[model samples]
Target: MPTQTRRSPPDGYYRTTVSSLAIALSAPAVAQETTGPDDGEVRAEQIADERRENPVDSIIVVGGRIDPYRIAGSADLIDSEDLRRFDYGDVNRVLRQVPGINTQEEDGFGLFPNIGLRGSPVERSSNITLMEDGVLIAPAPYAAPAAYYFPAIGRMQAVEVTKGAAAIRYGPRTIGGAVNLRSTDIPADGLAGYAFGQYGSRDYYQGQAWVGGDTDYVGALLETYQQGSDGFKTIDGLPDADTGFERQDYRGRLAVHTAPDAPVEARLEFVYGRSDLEANETYLGLADTDFAAEPYRRYAASQRDAFSGEHDQYRVTGSLAFSDGTRITATLYRNDFARSWSKLQDIDFDGDGSFDSISSVFVNPEDNAGALSILRGADSFEGAVRIRNNNRVYRSEGAQISLERPFEMGGARHNLAVSVRYHEDEEDRLQNEEFYSQIGGDLVFERQTDLGQQANREAKAKAIAFYIEDRIEIGALTLTPGLRYEGIDLTRLDYAGSDPDRSNGPTRVRQTNIDQWLPGLGATYELGDAILLAGVSRGFSPPGPGNPDARAEESWNYEAGVRYRSDKVQVSAIGFYNDYSNLLGNCTQSVGCSVGDIGDQFNGGAVTVKGLELSAAVEPRLSNSVSFPLSLAYTFTDAEFDSSFDSEFFGDVNEGDDLPYIARHQLYVEAGVNMGRAAATVGANYVSELRDNPGSGAVAENERIDDRIVFDIAGSYALTDKFSLFARVDNVLDNQYAVSRRPFGLRPGVPRRIVGGARVSF
Candidate 1:
């Protein structure tokens, strides 16, 4: 094993007293242990220990799973051990274990995850703050918060979620809380590395590797991950067509630091990452009857649908710590993303010029018999099927600086943090459409429109944000009060569809300016092995560039919870209420919006979302050589609109209409058996029925997504000190369930999958 030199804690006074609480309130943390070599585990353990002894080292919410009892608000950590047990590449599957989280799956895999926290809406995951290594990771978070490009979860080391007042420290969107993805870290000692490979059902395969080394003054790291699958869905009349996807990611890091004992220790690091994805995916779904007969079948018209994307990220971070207990950190980052998704948009059965949306056809199949026949490849159509290339490019760049200081005042220990950031982001859209005819179950190209004929626009935003938070401790009580301010300027430029080069200037220009202040307060009291926590926070979600008159989504969020921990058991329960003064919705193609209506925003009056979250974990030894570990998480939610409204996106709403796509109840359970070097685990998740549209009371047959339950199992055994073998079966019951009914028709969840892999370390 390699040896490491320990660095002194940031502040000796706080280290011996309330460092854990201070760290939890201030910064991001490495909150999980590694499942690699012995050295990797040791390094992870050391980092956790260091966090407990250093107040300024952590910069985000939530510390580690080992110390959730110390958190002052609702938070959770999905550590490495939990991730290794299932080896899931889909973020949707991993997040099911966390309470108070909801997901609407798309594309079977997690390619375009629709995530919601607390009571926020789950549309493209646009209502929450998303980050990686404490830096904002969403493409064009301000100009276009829709998450068309999400980080590859398989390359991450840990996942962290924070809610309520604890989440006030980060944002542009604070209503739904925040999610942070922690990437691999540079080794703390000599050379260290690990490699993992897996192959599974449906011709699926994945490979990942990382290597890193650290010296007294310098460190470097490199990592790569690749995955592919010949999807589980089959298209009509196309036996050889692949409904699969391929993805690749590469990252590199370099760092330089001063000597361990220097008066003012400092470190500077740089990171670069690139990723590419190509998927044969579509936004087409099936009719109710067709879905029941073949849940994993693709329509003949969607056989040519495809999506491709590329992303590049660059970041530089620097931090300095003074001997007198002051620390400052700064980061500069940039990201570029581009994607093109070509799919069927509409069809015209008659010779008339008017066209009908694909969703309309599915809703009233009898009225669109001719169009249905064309889609099923049972009849010939002439230039009726329209396919659009939804092309867009996004860029985000920002600089942030934060300072932390610990002090004592009025007989109370206090840790204060202040941060400021300047950010700019833009989204450019240049799209076109093509006509195709189906004859003899094959599509023939008719004519292609000029580039930019479908859409030609650019949205830009520049924002400045400042926030200050202070954590004060007296006796067994800790209180944190924070305030945040954001000022943003948004602009949208639209060009005529016939002018791709913009020689005649923009046809329309819109500008909007917004400023808001958010405040939060949290309190926690420790009593024996149990802690009581409560918080109240202001929630805000900025409007996109397309809507200059649209009001930002604002709410008042409140929560109270209790946590208890013993030697072998841990439990927590939280109750939360979010009162939305203004609920906002964005129209996108994924939500069954027409091409012309995409990017529009709708306002829904008053709304209320109340929920309860409960989680428990226990580990018991059955005998000298056997141990059983079990965990459970459950959530119950009640959400409804307080006022009636009408819009293109929300259809017709009543005063008591419930929010769509949000399950009333969700539960997850897991159990594991461990015997020395061998372990096996099983997990199950349950979701209650959901609505496809806003309504109350009884659900209509056409607007319901039935309840579902899924099970998964995994086992692992150590062959040697440096080698381990693992295998897993997902959806063991082989149940076919409807996951969503949007963008056209009914969609199915992932089918049964089996995967086996091995791990090697040095």
Candidate 2:
């Protein structure tokens, strides 16, 4: 199956809130529970020695970051310690070490990430299910899951990525996988608190503070985190404008245990986040000559662009455990958001309606010299520039219930999980376009040529999903069989653009409903302390609402892997093949989709994605108080179109054409040392060149992003039992390279930056 709470609070919340509920409901079952910088991750990493087992192959305790050996698929648990080690402001930097996941950096600040997993389209991470706690976090996940507003990773306790058969239990739209961001839970025992502050290059500032404790009956927590920067890029001749962003987050939580050992637990949480950006960003790539001269240069056209938005989330969760080994959990949640990005879209050389493509002017300077000169204000020109206001509102709400019960059958032990969810989400587009006359590098807003509304429509989805999985263990071998069912309803309403206010200039309404059942099976065999496993599953992604020509993305996926662990080292390797019957692509504003077709879906009939993932980690004792820890991860992805087709974005494609923007190779490694209360670490991230268009044409070279390796280092020393000083340097070598060629031109990674901070706890 590829596809919520209380009073039906707001939009898209239904699509992202269920994932949040799953984590909270299972809190009690995971015995490694604690309160710290990142409560959930801390709990998993520091399970009182007595309960600690081989992290690689142990299932002694269940938690947010599930162990690799405890499942029939792949799962990675990134903890607070990892975050503390590097202290990267952008989550993308931290995820580079994770195998199988791909990152496409946009703003360098990680404000809006373009990510993909297992060869799925990474345009905007719409193929994956994102959750906080265990519920969905995407705005309008059903109608549109572009992830324009991602969870604030800076405050998450831990981030969990899960794939394979087990993921069926958490989706109505499951093709790639699921990611859960755990939050700081209310303490259960002590009155604890922590505060941290940091400063760095480009006037970057950051702060995070939280306080929480538990009493005999109730627990509560209050937290706040905020950050801002002056930005790294500089515009030619526009020295007064700052290309930076400011983000703020606040969260509150309360929990009631009922009686000390009451068999039942409940918790409620509220989160609010805000972001304001004055970014000099655009979708106009520079000519090779211009890029070679200065890749960080911003176009004069994008100087007035800005992106701003806010999000609010609310959820209530409860868990019940029976004496007979039966457990049940229920969660209700809501999430709502509204955002607008006014950006330069196109330019007209004359007062006529005809317009020249921005790509032509930017990519072929010699051919379009006149246009380039006019655009850069190096020459006088009379033309009009179109600035589009990409505005949208989203809402999602849902409720989910999970039940686990153990039973004995045929001399084998069986653990069963049954889950059901009801979800609904909607997206409303209300956008405007303002026309401006440019002369001598100056812009004059003209209302006479205004396009009142670019987006005047609504799309919505409602779904019911049910899943069942049974894990049977017979001696040294285990087998798991799972099934998921999804029933979905989709609808769309459109108004003529001429009627800017949507006041009825010709209305069009459409709807589509679908049902699907997904099945998967997996098995594992143990050889001493090592494990070997394999699985096959049906993967699917829903078609967009009211798209008559779009088909659901469906695939038959197969995977196999191995894992081994010792007291000092751990290793895991996996290979996956996704044979697709159809591939679907969703249009998103960030990727330059016109506001009129922002949520449209396109089809790439047949495709295949295959890849390998490898990970290794070691901890060696140098001496009693000195030890070195090392980790390495690598991924090889081969994604291509299986049949010939034509696309407006990709131009033309042939059989076996490589998918755009997906690197064929990625690697990351880190090594560190610890001496009692002091620790240090250094790491490197590498990605091979990738193309922006599918076909291998002459322009391919210019479209491919340059390959590069980035290095970072970090260290920390304890000043006292409850205080510590930390320092880090990102891009330590300061080697500049292209990270993205979209929205256009080469966007470079953050330059060399050094930051220092101190953390205090009580």
Clashing pairs counted in every model: 5, 34
- TM-score of every candidate relative to the true structure: 0.92, 0.89
What would the per-residue lDDT of candidate 2 be over residues 1-762, giving only the tens digit for each residue? 011111222344435335634653454344322223243343223432212221111111264345555588777778777777876768798788789998888887888888888888887778888888888888877788888888667777677777776666677656677777776766657899999888988888778899998786777889888888888777656766688888888888877655555444333334333433334445554566766778666666676678877788888777655534555678888888888778877788654677655666645567777777656655333447777788888999998888765555455555677777888999888778877776556666775333445768888989878777877778878898988877777878877767766666437777776677789887888887688888888988888785666778899888899988778788989899989999987776556544236677888878899999999999999899999999999999999899998876555889988888788899999999999999999999999987877754433666778789999999999989999998989989988778877755567888898899999989
Q: Pick the candidate with the highest lDDT.
A: 1
User: What lDDT would candidate 2 get against the real structure?
Assistant: 0.74
Which ten residues in a row are the worst by lDDT in model 1?
1-10
Give residue 267's lDDT in candidate 1 (0 to 100).
90
Q: Candidate 2 regions off by >4 Å?
A: 1-65, 263-281, 378-383, 448-452, 498-506, 593-596, 696-699
Please give the lDDT score at residue 347 for candidate 1: 81
> Model 2: what TM-score?
0.89
1-762 per-residue lDDT for model 1 (tens digits) = 121212222333223223434454444222112123443344334444454354223445334443553456788888778888888889999999999998999988898899999878888998899998888888899999899899988888788888888887889898889998888888777899999989999999888899999887999999999988999899899978899999999999999998766777789999999999999999998888889999998889997799999999999999987654457899999999999999988887675866677888888887777777777776455788889999999999999988766555555655677887889999999999988888788889999899998999998988877788877778899998988877777888889999999888788777776677899998889999989999999999988766655788999999998999889899999999999999988889899876335777778878999999999999999887899999999999899999988876788999989999999999999999999889999999999999999999989888899999999999999999899999999999999999999978899998999999999999
